[model samples]
Target: MAILKHVAGKSADYGAALDYLKYEHDEVLKKPLLDANGNWVLRRDILLDGINCEPELFDVECEMLNAQYHKNQNYDEIKTHHYLISFDPADKDECGLTGERAQAIGMEYVKTNFPGHQALVCTHMDGHNGSGNIHVHIVINSLRKLDVPQKSFMERPIDCKAGYKHHLTKDYLKHLQQSLMNICMRENLNQVDLLSPSVNKITQQEYYARQRGQINLDKLNAELIAEGFTPMRTKFQTEKDKLRDSITAAAKRAKSFEEFSRQLQAESGISVKDHRGRFSYLLPNREKYISARTLGTSFDRNHLLMLFESNALTAEREKQQWSVADPIAVLYIKSNLRLVVNLQDCVKAQQSRAYAQKVKISNLQQMANTIVYIQQHGYDSYDELKKARDELSAKMSDARNTAKSTDADLKRLNEQIHYLGQYLSTKATYKEFLQANNKKIYRSEHQEEIAKYEEAAQFLKRSSPDGTIPTMKDLRAEKEKLLSTRAVQYESYAYFKDYYHELQTACQNVDMILDTGHTQQHSRTHPKRSHEPSL
Candidate 1:
């Protein structure tokens, strides 16, 4: 995936910016980013739109312009904008995109986007942490040094004068993202959702801390074990991870952004703050806040708003609600829905063997109970236990059969629903499918649409064995029934399986008692009788 990051720097000395750009940073590369020839690799550098300056003299040109025109502007005002456009590491081999191609893309991007600006474009082969992704660094002077012609949208030309600073608007940033997305798509390179936030994003400090913490933890664990102490480790949870979870939980429960913010504060004690057109989260204990944009794409203010707004407006109302028929089944239904293991079942499994060892009943009582249980039916010793096990197994087999049937029914229903949904969704194209005079011409024009509709029709025909296609309402109703049946059958299957396993375990215990020396004890007790009647 491609990542676009912008870092704006300001300094009275333009040389500082140039030095920072050219010099090797310990974070970015272990050694200086060298070319294939092994000299200091500034070979990929290109100076754009500067007549008097080469790549090396680009900083001097910027300084000269600043001294001439923007002398009154604050020394601390942003004089340089550094942009990092990194491609997917795999794209180099997969898409055959070279460092030179990346450099060209960067140059063209700057030329098209920041016209009349003096910019230094350089491509680096090494990424931070040996990532090996081809990334470009474009450092453009804040001042527009050439006159830019006014577009049709503008009323007047923009002249290069004192304080002719470029405005980095939100739209401009969005345009950069869109441009990057288009470039990747055109090259058939792997691309990420440019508009979406990444799931896991850590700061440089957190990244280094995590790396160090892992090493320290391992060392500490070893030392603790040597001292015969309990080895413990601290789990690191960043503010972003905490906020992401809190926000997601809040989103599920809250309808609106206002409610989401309130719920988030209630849940995690992090209050939402929007100041000067930026979204930040205020930690309860911290005076300074961190930007939401820094956290990840999903936590961005606009994205969050869109998500919560959609939930409030449409999704929440459209969601289906299912109910358990039996009150006790509610627990099972919830366990299934959450995909959580049953704690009671886990505890029972752990304590199962203890049942054999800890039984307080005397042998006499056990014998009496076993005799009574056997007497209720025609049962004898091992045969009785085996018979009981077989009955339980049979019931389990039946339950499993029902469950399998339910699954098949659900699968068919789902496929029907999917095809029906596709047909409904692509109705506009299907209309064109029907209206086409020349079939070949229509297929050529609306190839994708025609293919989608044809696939759906074929599936529908195959599914409708009775030669009547199912209506959406009919399919929906059938789906609801199948889902309901699936839940019931699944629960029954679990219950029968557990019961059968208990029977199996009990039978195995009985077998252990019968096969061990306990059986010899009975034989020894009846030694006086040469022949004993089988019970």
Candidate 2:
């Protein structure tokens, strides 16, 4: 994918930034190539139109412009703005774009977007870690040298002579991104949709850590194996991954922003801080925080607000429906409260009109009788209803755990059976491999087969004290035995599945009974009195 990386930084000394780009010193290099003092290697360097300087005189020309036109005399003040525009590395050979062609694209980009600025648009061939991605460095003097056309900055007319400074905004950045995409498309080069929804944006810190092979779990597992210790499952999920999954799940389940935020904190132990208009998630253990946009598009500030608005509209419509809904219809919906909470169930319920009608008919008759029973016995208090729901939820949780455990056992057993079968099938190949061990020559095609059998044999030896290799007949018998046991185990596990469904239905029934035709309020003061009817 063609990633448009935009890094903007102000520097008092423009030459330093220019030198860093041209010098080619990075962690990937075995030795820093800074021996050449002033003469740095550059693939292509060109000054834009109106910049009266050759590529060779880049430093002197920029210094002169800063000294003459720039009003701020302070040496520390930012006199130059640097930007990076890059493309995917594979584009070079794939798109047939030479270094000169890439430079032309960069030059055109600067001329089109950053007009009226004395800019040195330089294209570099050696990317980070020798990735070979052709990237452009657009170093422009902050002081404008010509009248920027109204088309470039539509908000206000730029008069370079009147000391008007160039301004960049989010919208302008997006516009420039679009222009780059267009340029790539027009020139028949490799391109990516820069405007696509950015779900996961990896930061520089994570990128460098991965490059350095500093991630712990992977290294730990390899070390454990090397030391003859069986490596257990490594909990490799970082705090960020957990937080992202939690937020994404909550966002999907929550009906409103308030509910999403509340559920996210309650479930994930991550507190949300909304300062000014930006949103950030603060991890409990870490002082560092991540922005909402950094998480994904679904968690963006604007998107969350839009979701809140949408949910509010939905609630309003539901409230209106509740006011005039038929008693049977209300009862039917109340009986399916579990469906309301489960997106998958709700989708299944809406899959077909006939199935939905069938559900309604079933709920209506049962609910009609339940409503009569509730009227005769008086309503169940909020606390009583909540207790019943909680009890059912507990049962469902236990049942789900049991099912998951059984499924895991089945999977492990199946994997073992498969490995044993493979080992038995490759016995002949293993004998051949043993003979080839001392031989000077062996067939290359048989190496893969030999390796697989060898790995299985070693694993089997580690598992068994005598290193017993099961015969094909024995392996088949064991597999058949496991299949038979699985059938019986599955039959037993069917009860938990049924139990979960029954508990969900019961919980939904209780919610239906409590939520309909009642204004129940909850309070901490006088528990019994608090549960009294609000109607």
Candidate 3:
């Protein structure tokens, strides 16, 4: 997955932007991480170069352009725009990604998307955090030196004109992100949903702050411990972190905006408000409110409403279930779904010595539900209950496996169909290149299209074991049939999954109650048995 990030530079000295890229920085101290030679240190697999300017004179060229364009002359104006494209660390081992290849992709990316700009493109193997992710840094001078041809994504007339600063509009940023995703897909590299909002969008500043905060907290904890004082907190949480936790916990059980707000206040004193369809959280004793976007996507209005809708549906389902039967106590199994419990034949399990340790006030509710479940299902013995659970589990597994297999096949067919289209689109270009007298020169002229055609052809050949390629029409027909099959398979899977969960919970609750009750009975009958050992 290639994650894209942008940071604008306001310093008038263009050299500062270049320095940060070329050198290493101690992130915590905001100073250069240097070597004995007094030069900035960096990873060994570093690839660096400048585009549309002399490598050494990149700053001079930018200064000359700025003077000529008479733009970005203000003291606090953005002098440069830095775009970072960080690829998945796993790609190095799984997909054989290297700094050199990543650099090439970065070059192609900048050339195609950011034309007519003096840009510096560089790649790093083990950046700041030393995560081993191959990331590219592309920093461009704010002023456009050459007029570019109008493109579909360009929004304004001055966008294509010289002397205009590079515009980082939301649309433009999205375009860049999509381009990265496309590149990842074409290259067979792991990719993420780059277009969607991040759930927890922690910036570099916040990330470092958390690290420093934790270190400070640990130090304070050690000092307090040495003085025979118990520290109140073992973990440190930033305000944003606290807010995220409070909002998520409140949202988990909240079914509406009003309920969510009340829960937030009652649980954590964080009052949430709706301002023009956006949710903002006001932390206790804080003057300013933090917007939902700053916290992450899951807290946004749309996501929260979707969560509430799901919660409402669950509530209705539970209501209907109870209306048809007794008040079934909720038996949480990871997911907080309400479940009816009853699998009462656990006499054999009650003999275990560990039962006494597990009993609590909650066991009473569980025991009642277990008895009701057994009576409703007519499970006469522990054997009968076990048999039912095992049978349902088998059915659930079969349906789940079938659905998963169908889904995988659909993905394969979709990728093949896309590859087939690519091959067809560029077949003419490949043919023309083959027939040309000067093969090398023609290949050079249409390198991109030819490369794409070959890549698609190879993939198609590998996919088709029988060497029989299906036409697009046939592929589409097959895909449709598979889609229909998948729908049916998923329906069965869903039904079995729900049934199995309820039955499984009933079995567990029954066993728990029997152990607790039987252990207590044995204790009353023979009080000294626990302390008395067999001779």
Highest lDDT scorer? 3
* Residue 53 lDDT, candidate 3, scale 0-100: 81
Ranking by TM-score: 3, 2, 1
In model 2, the clashing pairs are: none
Worst 10 residues of 1 by lDDT: 331-340
lDDT of each: 0.66, 0.61, 0.80
Candidate 3 Cα deviation (angstroms), residue 178: 1.4
Superposed model 1: Cα runs more than 4 Å off: 28-52, 151-163, 193-237, 245-282, 287-535
Q: Determine the C-alpha RMSD for candidate 1 after optimal superposition of all C-alphas.
A: 26.3
**Model 1: how far is 197 from its true place, Å?**
5.7
Best by TM-score: 3
Write out the backbone clash pairs for model 1: 197-297
Name the candidate, 2 or 3, with the larger TM-score value.
3
Quick one: how many clashes does candidate 3 have?
3
TM-scores of all predicted structures? 0.46, 0.48, 0.58
lDDT by residue for model 3 (203-293), tens: 8778779878988999988965674445646778888998898788777888888988987776577788888999888988898998999
